[model samples]
Target chain A: MLRLNNIHAFYGHVHALRGVSLEVPKGKIISLLGGNGAGKSSTLNIISRLIQPKEGSYELEGTSMLRKSAGEMVKHGVIQCPENRRVFPLLTVEENLKIGAYIRKDKNIKSDMEKVFTYFPRLQERLQQKAGTLSGGEQQMLAIGRSLMGKPKLLLLDEPSLGIAPILVREIFKIIKEINDEGTAILLVEQNAHMAMEISDYSYILENGRVALEGNSKDLKDNDEVRKLYLGA
Target chain B: MQIIVSGLIFGCIYGLAALGLVLIYKTTDLVNFAQGEMAMVTTFVSFTFLSQFEMGYTTSFLLALLFAAVFGAIVHQGIMKRLQSAPPLNQLVVTLGLFMVFNGLAGLIWGHKPAGYPQAIKGDSIKMGSVFFTPNEIFVMGITLTLMLIFFVIFRYTKVGLAMRASAQDIKASQLMGIKVTNVFTATWAVGAILGGVAGMMTAPITFLDTHMMFDVLIMAFAAAVLGGFLSLPGAVVGGLIIGVFENLIAFYLSPELKLVYTFLLIIIVLYIRPQGIFGGTQSVKKV
Candidate 1:
């Protein structure tokens, strides 16, 4: 449901995204894989309207999103669980979740919160606890759960498994697949290429601010160059 | 006993003013050195309403608060907002600049001479055992307590307060949650200025309204904030009271002229003992 064409982004003199383009179809998990400084996070940031691209045509369905602010993107059902699990450290878990649904005026917030609890039952136990006190794994869970509270149509997850333990990482991946199965389209940025390709239907591997390869996830997994570079097989 | 009673009365004013400083500092991470000057200007506005328009004391007080709110919003939007991306040192320097501007403008408009300002309530001191409480003293303490209660309730129970606290803790995270952080900053300044204005109006009757009326109160307020822990609201109030009572005790038992010196000495001693202030957490140290 989201499309970007010829998007070029810059951070001062450094060009982060150099004529890069990608698409996330409705209800599909699209994995964007790359090494460091490959512009994976910058692409997600542009889609979330956190940082505007100097040159691009970005649209949700057909409406342009280039002019919308980050707050407006949330209202348009584009929720981003940013890198580093940026939960409000001083606020309680419950308060953080409430803030997630900040733009909504509906009465179903309580139910939506319960829905978040179903995805991360541990959060229910730590409802009154401050988010900073949560374990890295739990904080990651809270970040995703918080985004889910927005009832997003398009979810942008930037490195959900960055610092998570292997066991918890597997569980998080399982939950991510389940979330997509329930009908929210996801654009995932990941460094764990094996798990990303295993779960995703389509994949794009980026190198030096450009898309170097794009194909079916299964095909890319079998590709020799992908195996040597990203999979480390 | 009478000295302590009067100390507590003045303590309420200092506490209120300190709360204003702490509020802005907590939310914006900028210490408003101009807080006292802002309060001084607002007091002059109230004086204008009372004398020029011949308004009732209650009307003038409420109108002054309204004026304070607008003035605060203008300061934030017109000046502080532009400095958001600047370094913390630069932002602090701008507030110091604002201190001079407000003081200069108030002097130009109201003149430097101190003038008589009326009390909220006019009556004899009510006697309760050995301690005597003037109606104005009672009025100041009552208003301070009520405002404190209202502020606590809003911070703990309301969505707007939640937004403010969230924005204060993490601006980027708050923005991701769809909060308009800029609006939160504006609201914080408005409330902070209102608190300052309240302290100014309460003190004017006793000190007499002048361009520099808030000078002593501002210093004590700063001491109160530092003693309470810069990050803690309740600490500011408690610190103000302690400073207030202690200053009075020093003045009575020792020398009146050396009260300011004694108060700062006490603050330095307290900081040496507990650098975070009584209520401040270790998180404040992490920022440095």
Candidate 2:
């Protein structure tokens, strides 16, 4: 569903991603695993066009995303539920969800928002409450709800489990699987290796800005090397 | 006491002007140093309708506001849109350039000589014990206060206002949600420009219309906006009034020459103590 070929990303002089490439098929949960500064987040950012790649070609389905402005990208169905739950903390739960669907000019917004609230019942109960006041788990749910409102065909979720309680992490992973089951392809980046492998159909292990290994999740889970370094078996 | 009464009136006008600045800045994250200039130009448009077009005075004033909004939208689409993702410094310079352009345009169009626009409301200056106020000045304050009320209402009740705020907080995110972010930005500039125009038009009768009239008020309007915590509408209103009354009291008690110095000091002290102003919460700190 998505492809990045020879992508090179930089922050001034420091190279963040050095000639990296990856691909994903349609309607599948693809997990990118890495430690800090492994370019996992950077890959998601490049696909979402939040940060421009110094040199690379990215094709979503088939069209090159290079020529599109951020506003244009939303129409192409590559939306991001950014890390740190960058929900508009000052805005209410409803307002934050409305923001997720900003690029839509359709009259079906009310229905879309209803769908979001249905997916996240906590958001419905706290619709008027400020997002910042919500618990970390609740905010993560709201963030995912907000992205779902965008109705992206390919969603890039960045560390949705980060900073949330462990129990909440499992719940969030279950919801992500539900979202993937509903036909929206997902590119999930996570530090929680076990859950990512559990939910993702295909997984890529990233280290030092390059893909170190790629395989089916069950095989990766059974692999001794991954078990030793990442799984801690 | 006279200083206090008059201070309230002048403060209301400054508050409206500062509101204009804050609205544009909130969305674009741009200080818009040329905001005063935008006001100057729009008010001049009013000056044209009233003096040259021979239209009814009230009608001219209303038309001037419409003209200002349109002018603001044009400037946004043509100029500000290009600078949307540009660095703050570059955007700042663009507005500073606009400041010079608008001021220079005013000078070129109407010579450096200042002109006084006629007031619609006229009556004897009312005296209440130690205070004094003309009916027209009171009317001007009423107009400003009414505009502020309208702003509050629109911001609270309207979908457009909510969308505008959402866009300001997260432009890219808002865009994904199907909000035309460019339209929001344009609307902000339009509101800001119309406000500046009104301030210029109303204040022209109080302080003669000249290219530099708004310039003198720039620092204080900016100070008021910054002091308001840079994001809150109510904060801008309160901040502007505080600065206005304070400046007037200084002029009454001390010397007129020291008034600018006093307001300047107020700004520095406010920023030093609370860099976020009164309402703005710092989120993204741009890399220097």
Candidate 3:
């Protein structure tokens, strides 16, 4: 559903993503494993059109995303739940969800919101509370819930496990699997190798802005080098 | 006693005036330098309608408010939206162009001669022991306070108001969720123009209905905004009251000419110390 071929991204003078290439097939979880500053996030960001690709090509469902605006990507159902859980701090949980379906004029937003609440019943309880006050895990849930509100075909999740409790991390992984099972494709970037492999269909290991290894998530998890570097075996 | 009464009365007007800037800032993160002129322009629209059409003053005033709102929404969408992602300084430049354009347009359309608006309230004053307030002044204060309260309720309880607030806190996040960010900006500007229109209509009765009146109080109102910290609704009111009292006290007790200068000095000192007004919120910083 999403493809990136030789995509390079730069943050000012620093080369962040160097010719990263990948294809995420529809209705599967594709985990991108990399250390800090390995351009895993940048690769997902380019595909979501959050940041521009300095070189190479990024396509969403066969259409080139090189010149697409962030708003356009949102319209095409390419939603990014950016790292750090960038929820609208002042907005109520309900308002944040309402904003997610911002581009779609579809009248089914109300029912879609109900579906989101089913995934995150906690969010429903705090509908009036400001998003800023939510606990780290709750905020993560809100971010993911918000992306789902967009009715996205391909959701880019950048480190869903970051800053959350370990128990919640497992819960979040299960939710990710449930979401993928519901037919949406996912390109997930993570440093949590064990949890990622447990859920992902395919995986890619990135180093210094390039993809160093690509394989089935189960095969990569079994590999001694992959386990030692990523899983701390 | 008269001093406090006068302070309370004009403070209401100033608060109404500052509300426009506060609403715009909260939604768009950009300051509208032309806000004062925009209000003045809208007031002139009221003035023209009153004169050209024997439709009378009050009905024409309402029409002007609606027209100004339409004007504001158009400018916000057509002009400000294009420069939204541009640098802060560039956004300020667009407002500057708006300031000059609104000022020149008002002058050309309304002419230099001040039109005398029919008195909104009779020149009657109510005496409460040692203090007295004119009927018009009392009306102005009442209208401002009532509207502010109504506005607060709408913002706190209404869906659209919540959406506007959401857009202010984070545009990108709001956009992702399905909030039409463009319409939010337009709504903010439209509301801003309405507030500005109301303020001008209030001020016109006290001063001669002229474009230049906004020029004089613009700086004072702006100083009130800066002192209260931009984007703060209540802060603007408090700051305006403080400015009204402080400037009046300084001019009356100290020196009349130094009132304007002293008010700005207060703003500079305010900025030097708290930069953000008491109510102005600081965005959360995340270090990855």
Task: Please give the range of 10 consecutive residues that has the lowest summed lDDT in model 1 chain B.
Answer: B148-157
Quote each prediction's TM-score.
0.98, 0.83, 0.79
Best of the two (1, 2) by DockQ: 1
The parts of candidate 3 lying over 4 Å away from their true place are A1-27, A33-78, A92-129, A149-154, A165-167, A181-185, A204-215, A223-233, B1-3, B121-135, B245-256, B261-278, B281-288
Q: How many clashes show up per model?
A: 0, 14, 9
Task: Flag clash pairs in model 3.
Answer: A99-B177, A99-B178, A100-B177, A100-B178, A101-B177, A101-B178, A102-B177, A102-B178, A102-B179
Best lDDT among the predictions, by candidate number: 1
lDDT of 1: 0.93
**By lDDT: ranked, best first:** 1, 2, 3
- Could you give the CAPRI-style class of model 2? acceptable
> lDDT of model 3 at residue A233?
90
- Per-residue CA lDDT of model 1 for B267-287, tens digit only, reads 999999999898889988777
Looking at model 3, give its docking quality level: acceptable
Instruction: For all candidates in order, state the fraction of native interface contacts they contain.
Output: 0.77, 0.43, 0.57
TM-score ranking of the models: 1, 2, 3
lDDT of 3 by residue, B184-241 (tens): 8998899888888888887787778886878766776777776777667888877777
How far off is residue A220 in model 3, in Å?
Answer: 3.7
TM-scores of chain A, one for each prediction: 0.99, 0.97, 0.98
Q: Which residue pairs clash within candidate 1?
A: none
Clash total of candidate 2: 14
